[model samples]
Target: MFMKWKFFDKIPVEGGVSYQDLAASVGAQGEIVSRMGQMLVSTGTLLQPKPGSVAHSRLSLRYKTGNSNGSAFAMLYDDFQPVFAKLPGFFGKYGPNLPVGKTNIPITFASGADGKLTPWEVFAQQGTEHIEQFGLAMQAMTGYLWPHTGAYDFTWVGKYAATNPNRTLIIDVGGSFGHSLRANLVKYPNIPPGRCAVEDREEMIPSITKAHANDPVMENVQKVAADFHKEQPVKGALIYFIRRCLHDYDDNDCVNILKILADSLPEDEPQARVLINEHIMTDPPDREVAAIDIIMMTWASLERTVQQLEKLADRAGLVVIKVHRAGGSSLGVLECKKASRS
Candidate 1:
């Protein structure tokens, strides 16, 4: 409400916009606006400069319309409100355990489509608007929730790519619009774009094609419209990079996805890697990780720890080579290789 009316930018540090002026500017009832403003004030997001006036608190100032990332918070709230409200009922009807099936999760349960559609299908029904917001929200997330800075020293892939330019260096499974791959290319220019690929659903190919035109580095990236659950068509790739994907499915499904990548590794190259980039849910996890675990439950998934990740890789016939993570960071890159090939 405040953002739409530019209250954060309009209100000065010493003074504030009166309730009458703010309400009139936005064609809303003054009393209703005042009530809504009060809710924000209680949260330290807004300031009640006077009995009938409101101003931007230090926190609120950061939410100005110019800050595109703030839209992520709004999008999540708007899209997940119904699902969040139905969590208790979903557990009651489907049992208290974490949802087990893709088609019967909290999202599907909330929409009364339980056992009928996956969360993605439910979102598809809503058309592209929600998905567009979701994309932006994800972009915003990359800024903080999953900072790519020093995440895994992706620069090494550049040298790895130069070793055999014709051999595929990376296949980013389930990478949406190739944004992650594009960022990596920018960071590590030596990583030949033609040697890397990004696989996603067929419907997303047009967008990926459009996105590729936006950045020259992405021009040579091979965009493959393939499902990760099925056979991996690109064989013998040096690196199969799957980020924030395994945590989206159950253990059985995660194992299958890993196995597909494991199978794609060349027998001669024991050093071939499968990089899993995800958050490690700790014992008595920090508030952030714990909160994310519950949120992911809405989609019938949970974050995994290092030990849990190792077990998943082992089940997929792969061995965890090492965990690359900076101190005080729960997000890590679990580097793995095919056990049989090793």
Candidate 2:
């Protein structure tokens, strides 16, 4: 709390402690602390306070508190308390790769050319990584912090699925395990089971499949093992759901991924819609969500502006037909169709 409070309170202006002073305060000890410090330096959480000092690097962030719901301190506490609570059990049994051991690399969302991790990707990757490292308890922390419950993402995606009464084939690209599809199925209860297909890395298949052994809905969902960089196997898919996937990669990679999908579709297939579900960064950054911008930086991803999306769509031979904001949600639904020329 002391370090976090100081970190949130101080500023590196004309007068500040040297790097040496900062290091001393933290009590530099074993390899773990060193490694943790290195991560902080790399993630821009800690920096050189003065010329040749060896203390903890001086750190500062411009933040204000006092909101009705909670202050910044409250938010940080609320966000991290759960993680800290489960740390012993999750880390003790699972190992140290989870978010517990002060090894977290803060993400900085890059919208510009500087190139960094987008907020959504940071949250998604970290959330998924947490679950992978620490098991179910860590998953709870992720579920709590990110895409927080009652935010309307799953509900709306289910509604979208419901609209396609034609037994439309839904391909969930890069869908982690079958979590999203399963959630959507619960929302659209009437939707048939056979219409859902999830594509992910080969390694994730067996584990995810085993985890869903008891789920009756899992029978209908096909798990396809393929790389997103290659051509999409299912042609003329009714809807290609790329939720929170693109932002994990840079522009060139996204274009390549989209090209593969575009090439797989029949040019005349009107049912083919590329649905990109992501948190579109507002032009003027929203301060409330600003922490995410910094989070993206550590991971080499970005939250793009609307213009960026359009340009990327044009390059991929897709036309942005409509942009629908998910009701009471942070993510946007970009409905795209193949371009006439492509």
Candidate 3:
């Protein structure tokens, strides 16, 4: 909290400052700042090259302003902290099994709307700053950990887009700031511009546009505002790419979202695909994946296994075609198609 709200962020990254000086700069008590500084240093974040003097360690440098990791820190401080505080009571009341329907852990505890609103809605009510910070945090988390192009093969999609000039290539559902789409386009230049589009909430359009304003890849990437829970507006796109979206909700809501995508597929185009990019839990669960699974519980969601994804796909009237695992990473690109009725 001190780092996010005060001392750590205020101190110069290159130079060392005494804890007392740092605290004075932020109007915080010297003793409190000293304790926090020592904690950070002990944890391999900040460094004290000289006694009583603190500076940014290599790791701490990542959390400076304008850095994605910095945004992540802000997100942790502003968003998750409150929700996590309520976890004990929530788990005690609800038990291990999460509630069905739209009521989620974050909604149950963090929402002021009497468990009526989703986390996104709560963020919306909090205004733009909250939304922007969340977006940045997501960017930092994904960009730093997973290389989107390396994670999934977009060659086939690019080839299809190159050949089918009239058809849309990729529709990034809930794509914030077009980061995933932009990354794919950068990797696959053969995929023509204007053939790709991104759909997000209406409030996100301006920020998305501004985010991609100067990027040549996004010059042709269309940005549309639409709710995912409602019927999908765009139809017959070669691929509907959803990354880190479904895990935000429970199984029922996941089914609803996938069903809408499935329903939008062109009847004649059996080849159209829905690509889901998420962390897939393994048998000997990766420690990080396991940790995320528990953390997602705070939002009434979980990191699903392959079988779990398949079952969820089945419920949505879709068939899981492939699970493309990112090499040496827990992230998987699960490919699905509309289930055939014989």
Candidate 4:
């Protein structure tokens, strides 16, 4: 809390600020902020360059407020205390196993919406801020922190777009605020915005529309109000891209979602694609991957491996063609095609 309130990228690197002053800046009690600063200092997250004063430590520099520290943005996902507290009770009601679907998870139960509403629904009911925070937090995870642009080469899509200007080149399903589409436009101006589209839930469509209302970059980019759980309304697109959304669902739900895209593919073209972009955990699961996997447990979701994704694709009547991942990227694109026409 102290780190988010004060250390947000605006802290001075060489000078120490008094805890009392820092607390005053954030309108908090002095004694409490002082205590928290001392605790952070002990943990090497803050430095006592001088007595009674604190400065950003080597590790805490990234936590500066205005900066895009994905870790910091994630810590703001919500008050997770209640969520973790409900874990045992949630399991007791269900069974002692990893969660699979969207409903009745730890977060839903903690929010007092278990079996009544999904987390997204719960967030929507709370207010716009909650939903917006969740969206920005997720964007932080995939947009800035561990961006997929580096992991996979998308410039080739631009080349493809140039030749096929009128074809539906990409459809980003469940894309929030059309970030991916905007990104593609920036990278490859050859991409015809009119030929691209973003499909999301009904409630979220307004926000997407508002975001692109006056933005020239997304002028002609199409927006569709659609649900991935149901059949994909947009058909025969060159790229049916689902980015960072499947992990929100379980194996069965994921298979169903993938099947819709597979069913919508242009069989004769053979180039129509179903690309799933998400983190693919290593076989042994590295520290970061393991941590994210646990975080996903909040909603009974998971960070899957390529092999696991292959199984899910096969179940969905899609065949995994290849997984594209560059070195140092935390996410990958699972290139897929329809398993069979019949």
Candidate 5:
């Protein structure tokens, strides 16, 4: 059910279906394919041709690696066109309001969970297989969310940290390979060593450390093998950062992860902030944001809207103090604070 609409990139030699037609046959609305298709085209990542005639419209979109049937978008289109031609009323039958090939509806992962697989447990169990697919998904996602730098409102954060470079602690929790750190470092020269730290899985430390060996500012940048879901290592860092990490799990998982994060901080810091980098879906349903919601659903994750994120923060014993829309899209820079004891 989940795989029915996963984007496929290749053409089938024999299926005789086109991507567009398959999209039509499955009762998928034009907006879904158009949005996803336009995204691929906009990034110059891939090209897709709309079939000239209904006869040549059907295609197969084989999403997986070993699919013997027509799987590519082109193939999917080929497969789709014929079905539509044969049954002229398919589009009218399902219509845009119905769920034709909608990807995420939450029911999918629950089925897996019924089999006793928690989301991350599923990831940990599948290990490399899941990671590889997830990584590819991330790559495609990054492209769609172009100008990724704008996603975090890093400019504002850097400017603020620059005011007290020596005292500020910029900890990128779950920061993978120091990429975001470097991005911030390059933008904000006022920040210095011992100020920024990156914490991630133990397995990633060596390579990340080696990569930063020559970085003078990062020399004091502590890199630790830590889990944000269990506990944070630092006492009361000025900022605890998480980028694209929370959306990988369900609501309960996020609550537990945030609880661990909140507990790790000290009670008496002048100011402590928890920054989450993620997309906050639009309420009325924008094409791109809705598309990602489906993707997250398939991966056993959720991308909350601004109100929902704030609510999640409150549940975790923190308050959403501020939100910076660095770009118009779903991504936002959320700053949270511990509930005031007073």
Candidate 6:
């Protein structure tokens, strides 16, 4: 039903679309369309004011054309679902241990050319539309939470930028589309122009540029293409901000990513910080956090607790200075700095 009619894309948000009209547009039989429409209505995705016509529900509106939430749904349904289907067999063979090296479930289930690619590589290979959709989905996922400003104060960084003549103020490593940076710019407009930079894979630069082209927030934001697994190129940045990026890798990779960032900080500059924005799993975990933990497991990544994060930081020669939790949400800003050599 999702693929056939592009129901979410084609249906008008303000009014109902008839089942017969939807079926004709998709070239599907009327009876089948009716059945699927009824099923969707039953699932609360659509509302049936009458027998043959369906209207958008609040839930269904999210998947409308040009909506990031819809893009996210497409990424999960079209891309991740196949990997999920292979999980039972994957666990049967690999014993449910976190996949490492080349034992990726997505690759295992993927056909032909994609069978050999890592999840990141696979996304890169799919071209621009796929990458943009994935990014939009990520933004949609975090839209419910408090903005990044609410979680981490940028005033200090702005002040630091004002005083520090030569130093980079912020480097958003693995930051896709500069959403967090854009938000920061909106919140703290005084942050020095040309002091902030965003790094992602080479494929993502153009899209990032286009995404923030019109916004004054991104006017001075530098877009650099660098792999996060390697040493971060821009050095001595006062703040290296990583939001929702580390949770995509396993523990070892997470340690390495942090270590590289940690190594880049100037030893004399104690104020330099690495801000990690992600979900900190609760003691009695919330259902949303628990559910996402399982989803992240598909890629062998995970959401970390405060203890887990601390350990990860310690392993990377960094110390967790504070964990700022947003009120009424599972998100946290884990502030870390280089461990003092005592």
> Cα lDDT of model 3 overall?
0.79
Which has the greatest TM-score?
6
Residue-level lDDT of model 5, residues 10-36, one tens digit each, is 334333334466477667766666565
TM-score for each of the candidates: 0.82, 0.55, 0.86, 0.79, 0.59, 0.87
The TM-score, computed over Cα atoms with residue i paired to residue i, of candidate 6 is 0.87
Candidate 1 stretches greater than 4 Å from native: 1-68
- Candidate 2: residue 321 lDDT (0-100): 83
Candidate 2 on 1-342: residue-level lDDT in tens? 323334323334444444444445566434444455456566665554544321233332322121212233443353344444544554454455422111232222122211344333334355543333222221222233333223233344445557755544678888766565666667667556677788876666776677667779876688788779886777766678776777756688888888777676656556577877666788576553355543332344567777787888889988888887744455666777888643
1-342 per-residue lDDT for model 4 (tens digits): 764575434457878888777777878888887787789889998889888788877778766543335344544455466777778898898889887667778888888788888877877887764565555555564554467465545677778877766678889899877877677678777777888898988887777788788988876788899989997888888889898898877888899999999998986677778889988899777676787788778888888999899999999999888899856766888989888743
Superposed model 5: Cα runs more than 4 Å off: 1-148, 151-168, 213-220
> What does candidate 6's lDDT look like per residue over 1-342, in tens digits?
564257777777788888889888878898988898889899998999887999989888777655777887788787777777777777776676776654445444443332376777667767788888888888775556535568888887777777777888889898888888888788888787588898988888998888778877686689999998997888888889998887888899999999999999877688999888888887798888887788777777888898998999999999988988777778899999999743
lDDT of 3 by residue, 1-342 (tens): 654565657768678888778777768888887887788889988888888878877887667655667888788777777777876666677676664445545544665453577666678888886787778777775653655667778878777765667877789999888788888888888888688898999998998888778888897789999889998889888888999898887899899999999888777776788888888888899887887676687776888988998998899998988888767677889899989832
Candidate 6 — which residues are off by over 4 angstroms? 3-5, 23-31, 49-51, 104-115, 143-147
Model 2 whole-model lDDT (C-alpha atoms)? 0.56
Q: How accurate locally is residue 85 in candidate 1, as Cα lDDT from 0 to 100?
A: 93
The total of clashing pairs for model 6 equals: 0
For model 1 the local lDDT of residue 180 reads 76
TM-score of 1: 0.82
**Which is the better candidate, 1 or 4, if ranked by TM-score?**
1
RMSD of each: 3.8, 15.4, 2.9, 3.8, 11.7, 2.8
